[model samples]
Target: MATPNKENAPQHGTTGTAPLLLSRVAGNASAPEILIATMHGKEAVLAPALALLGFQVLLPVDYDTDALGTFSGDIRRPGTAFEAALEKARRACDATGVPRAVASEGSYRPSQSLFPGARNVELLAFVDRESGVEFVEYLTDVPTRFVKGRVPADPAAPETRALLAEIGWPAIRAMVVPNDPGEGVVLPEQVFKGIDHEAALAEAFRVCATHSDDGLVHLETDLRAHMNPTRMASVALVGTRLIERLRQEGYASAHPQFA
Candidate 1:
């Protein structure tokens, strides 16, 4: 999805201080607290946007984001990105007992237009329980870097090392899974912290190939915001869009007030 041209809509302005703005503008909307659920390390970028919009942002430590689906393509998530994001938001609402919450989900793969490369779609949803309204913002393109390759038998070979380097090795992690069919045994090794030695890649190769049909192990770019710079940047853009949607006063009239 491409980024939409943001026209200067009056309903989406945040100029005054938090307290002053809330008192004068958002008073009609119930719920003063907001929550953003993510395990993608998006907090660094998203928190500031919500703060500037006059909503207290909360992240419950117990939130299990993987339940929504992982980037490694394991445990296929149910429903579309919007459904998954809404599910995350509702869970946050349940955990914090807050009437307002936010959640985001991203999916990446080959572009429908252009085959066999990379394209990404990000969905950010704002749920106001008081208004029973869900305001969503989405973007495609997003400038992401994702790749897939077959693990080589000589994991320590120069060619294998070059592939890792291209994917931002230590900075971004990779997921190793069987390229065959059966049970998708995925072992996600955090190449970030320790062990740059080929031993790690060698071990990943052995595990995936053993279970695969063609004796091939698959590795792909981990799309987590913390791991992938491209994903983190996209989160920031989506957060800003969500904040703008939440700031709009007329959304209440657009949807029925719940509580």
Candidate 2:
């Protein structure tokens, strides 16, 4: 059981696994492996950073991470992002037969004291079982790419095209879902590249609207690392922090508490 003072020891809906691991840094090649558990598709940005620190970075294949939660707002995650991140890290360690892991989780919303769309926060974590150390990091910004708008089902709506340009296109991808949140239908793949033709986008919107509860489609940026460059940048920043924590001198020394 995790202690109450622990940052991630609340009611996270996950099975049994140690909350953290610790590593004693040696020379370069023999450094312990660190698994980065994520469904946000972070391998490209994060793996390099771990490699730079001489720790092998691993990602699990068989686990269904969506069981934890998803970005489409369908599943209500039980714990805070920190708890969820530790759960994910523990899952990776269990699956790979390794003792150390790393994971990250992100949340986005408008500024509480501001207008409808204002700012966002991203949280990242690194969990080590050998030393029982879990390090947390965060970043905040008001220039997020999150936005949503309702468009008619019509294939040739002029307003839809205008909205597309308003949001950075051909670069930052958009999420397509039913305007009604209750319908539980989100088409993440329907995210169209702004570089694609207007006809393609119109068709995409039409398909989403046809199945929507209110015959309206909601469009917003995908926000996943591979989809949104802004998110990728954030992942890179998080990766740098994780690497630094792993390289700490205190982690290099032996500790009786771990034994």
Highest lDDT model number: 1
- TM per model? 0.73, 0.71
lDDT, candidate 2, equals 0.59
TM-score: model 2 vs. ground truth: 0.71
RMSD of each: 10.4, 9.2
- Looking at model 1, which ten-residue stretch has the lowest summed lDDT? 19-28
- Candidate 1 TM-score, true structure as reference: 0.73
| Candidate 1 lDDT over residue span 66-162, tens digit each | 8887666555677677788899887766555567777888877534552234367878887877778876788877766676677664577666667
- Computed on alpha carbons, the lDDT of every model, listed in order, comes to 0.61, 0.59
lDDT of 1 at 33: 56
lDDT of 2 by residue, 1-259 (tens): 1111233221212234633332212223345566667655676677666655665455553345666766665555556666777787877676656677777776664435522343676667777777677777766672446666777766457766566666675477665666533235445553343324556666777777766767867766666666777787787777676666656734322423211
Off by over 4 Å in 2: 1-30, 110-118, 142-144, 180-200, 249-259
Off by over 4 Å in 1: 1-31, 110-118, 180-198, 250-259
lDDT for position 80 in model 2:
68
Predicted model with the maximum TM-score? 1
